[model samples]
Target: MSDNMFEFAFNPGEEVVIKIKAPDLKNKMGGETLQHLMGAKREMLLALRSLLDDAIARTDAADSPAEKTHIDIE
Candidate 1:
């Protein structure tokens, strides 16, 4: 496999976060094709990928939904 081992994750809704990490495109693939992406860390885009993943996993269906929250403003 090439150093182009790139992947991403994205969650779309009220909040938007985009994270990107891949081998320097021009160095290997000359260009890249994007897949799913995740949360954004303006300083280090790469690290954001895991941050979102972990967060989502915590809320995964397999886990108990025993503790959910709802808020309304009036």
Candidate 2:
């Protein structure tokens, strides 16, 4: 719950977290601090958008006879 990091639990046993700290990411990507900060935000937004869209599609397709699935790849 810190200011620079965020943790999200998508399901009871599933988890998804996203942390973006610009100062800590200095010189990591090919850009300045501010640029990297903004880029990270944009990328994160796009990723979340895609995830939400997929969730919506699945929800609307609840009538489909798809069995529960789990993939474990380590």
- Give the whole-model CA lDDT for all candidates, comma-separated: 0.48, 0.69
Off by over 4 Å in 1: 1-13, 19-45, 61-74
Provide TM-scores for the models: 0.26, 0.51
lDDT of 2 by residue, 21-62 (tens): 434554554557668677877898788789889999988899
Looking at model 2, report the run of 10 residues with the lowest lDDT sum. Answer: 20-29
lDDT of 2 at 30: 53
Q: What tens-digit string does per-residue lDDT give for candidate 1 at 9-71?
A: 457665553333444434433223322221212335445657768888877856765777899
For all predictions, the C-alpha RMSD in Å is 12.2, 11.9
Q: Which candidate's lDDT is highest?
A: 2
Error of 1 at 40 (Å): 14
Off by over 4 Å in 2: 10-31, 63-74
- For residue 57, model 2's alpha carbon misses the true position, in angstroms, by 0.4
